[model samples]
Target: MNSPTAPRRDDRPQDDRTAHRTILLRGGDVHSPADPFATAMVVERGQVAWVGSEGAADAFADGVEEVVDLQGALVTPAFTDAHVHTTSTGLTLTGLDLTGARTREEAIAEVRAHAAAHPADPVLLGHGWDAARWPDDRPPTRAELDGATGGRPLYLSRVDVHSAVVTTALLDLVPGVADRPGYAPDAPLTRDAHHAVRAAAYAAVTPEQRTRAQRAALRHAVSLGIGSVHECAGPEISGEDDFTALLRLAREEPGPRVVGYWAEQVAGARDAEKIRALGAVGAAGDLFVDGALGSHTACLHEPYADRDHTGTAYLDAAAVASHVAACTEAGLQAGFHAIGDAAVTAVVDGVRAAAEKTGLARVRAARHRVEHAEMLTPETIAAFAELGLTASVQPAFDALWGGDDGMYAQRLGTERARTLNPYAALLRTGVPLAFGSDSPVTPLDPWGTVRAAAFHRTPAHRVSVRAGFTAHTRGGWRAVGRDDAGVLVPGAPADYAVWRTDSLVVQAPDDRVARWSTDPRSGTPGLPDLTPGADLPVCLRTVVDGRTVFVRPDE
Candidate 1:
């Protein structure tokens, strides 16, 4: 598939240092997840200096500084979500969204029009709110949010932040949460009483409203072509000054490229210097050994085929072997959030007993990770390929909860809900997958997460579309160690995505080859429209990092 005129080879570095501005791009159709199709790259000052064809643009026409051409469309790369929360998807894009509220009286008329246009108070907070497509499947009480917020103190949330639906003046401001322990005398609020009213409305917002809800969730992940994000952030309910105020407001804004991950819980990983100042800013995020399979509290090794429960293991194996030996002796690269199968065999026996009490080549050179090894068990996917770890998944939660009347066959009934999120049985047991959109609990669309890991609505968990676009580009930059951020060629990182088809590399038998070219008003159904398509028409005219940050509306 390398034809624009094929004859390329520029593998970078030949420096006499001064020929930098190149772009070129030429007659498009490049895919390069290390080739699944398309071809013709080039770039330069941002990296990827020359991929082939279109007669390799006359060998970069004496160091061309701009070419672009692309009369073919469909390039790739620029998509790396790998788990997100980026200031709760930028505070669910400035709150009161109610995602696609089908009912609970249309999510209480969108929280009574955002508590009557923000009537100053400690209570009007709102969030996603899907009482499983309510029609009385129940969830809006607290006397129906105190008769549509008139008594103020409302709360909302519940598109799986594991529950929250407060009111009654936020249950009289959290007093004895109707007898706690994930409260539910007929679900008064919910799960740990809506995780204490969503940790007191995310600790009473402000820090300039959490930097304007994380720059409106990094401008909706750079108008949906993503780039990078792993934020995660929970530390007993977000702190470390909310991930150093979202990495100092994403290093003084110009969005996307976050990678934070410090949701510790499980007794805050026995604070070994706050897990080495959250692995001193570079091993890129993780921590959590259970909870989430829509809060049945994932930690299963049998016992959730219609609940008599057998989950919930948030650390206990000598506190996840002393927080994976204090995050692998402080150089940090540990992750955990295992989605049951006894929390992926208690985090693969706590990272194989913290790599045999420290020293499996210093925990495989600190590349450790697990986060949602969903419900694996081919001996925990061959112990995640004999402990090189890193799974960090979320194939759009198996295309919106792998259907056939979803929610894992009504809560784990169909043979342990046919092991969700296997990603082709963890890449045929060599295990090392990565792709995420846990964003405000899913909807960040890396091409609808590579079409739900390539149409894997359970056909034994599909996977292919060049293994879901190299698990969302270079296995999410080698799960955050970032070897030059996802690929393109020459020297990487000129971050990509051009596609209005070539369909993320010829795997389109359905999802009409990565859909979207229209439809996005948050109807929230398989998002794609970063608008461009009209017969080979993808857009992003200039998302260049050496200069242009998102440009397409005809450039």
Candidate 2:
């Protein structure tokens, strides 16, 4: 590693920016591929200057302006969440959250309390209530919600965000929503009706509220050691105004970097230009090819075990091909929200067609993404690798609902559930895997996400801790076409986090490999112990571009 030499006294400026651009952090374990046993690192001008042992660090101790004693902490690359809904996540942070409610009664009680507390609010919005977790598997009815809110307008989204239940007052805001597809007089709304009501509810949020929510979400992410987040904004998800506002907020603030994606289909250069004008990196993310499985709306080849229907299909293969071709031609990334088997099949066939229509090299070079590719087949997984599609997945999905009795099994039967989120298969086939939390649907817990993948409910899908960590960090950067960021190495972006952790150990999907690599002679770096039920590492500090973004309180 090359160390930065000190400038002469005459060349060194008195200005803080010039003098303090270099910082040396020593006396800690640095997780870096550059040096597996790295003990110290130097950051200069928002980039990693060098990484070496403690003795080597002494050579340039006086050259840097600031010296930090890491005091045995573990330093690793800050995480990048590949899929996120910024404003909505913020709203959940500031508004009502029903993630902890176990039964229908508990969810109703929480809603009533929130409505009573915020009496003056125009529309009460809440998220993360799963009927599948309830004893009777019954969602809160519209009548029950009406009584809970005392006729106040309310919209409560299911855990998946694919469907929601609303009070009649909120329903009144969307004209003819009752006649929309997937609408029922009693149960939670799905498909078109769910989208209509969700839009109406979010429209009621004031500009100030929206800003507060966005700030809260970003702040929460940075505090958890997340350095960057990809905002998956779209027309049906959150309007153009909301998406642009979030990008502006992230730019003006000193928080995690926000890479925006407008999930809109493109026809040609004009559409791509419009997306770029909105400050988006791609015209991709959450462009719904199908809804989520929890709502029984994920497009499947066969009928769901519980439901007689095969679920919803928002976009067909032809439409997906057209979108992919347009994006490839325009040099913009095209992606979709596909979860079910049929939806995954459509994405594979469509991208294959696009690669044939547009030059395969160009299509592959774009590195387009697929969000929540949960139910992938071996064929589709192979196609993803062939087409160079990045799987921006949330491992927390499996943690929350992937066991024998979890929601996946309930919806798709135990046999099909085992096939969901085949990370091992995808990785083995050379498909790029980018991990995310899909916050608001699942909380932004980076370490938890890594652990979930490392200790997947299905043993066949689990990956090593190191691989999982890389998927959460560097893989996200690669998805955004950035090869130099998201790692601790010379000339790479100085985005990292300091953690208070237990003894580091090499953990793998197989116990034998983990045991064999524990010796220092193995040259394998270690991460915090992530055995099931073990306490996760705590973020002591998070830095982005050589600037500290979060410092744990009372540390």
Best by TM-score: 2
- How many times do residue backbones clash in model 2? 0
- Each model's lDDT comes to 0.65, 0.89
Q: How accurate is candidate 2 locally (lDDT)?
A: 0.89
TM-score of model 2 relative to the true fold? 0.96
lDDT of 1 at 162: 57
Instruction: Give all candidate RMSDs, comma-separated.
Output: 21.6, 4.7
What TM-score fits each model?
Answer: 0.34, 0.96
Q: How high is the lDDT of residue 224 in model 1? A: 68
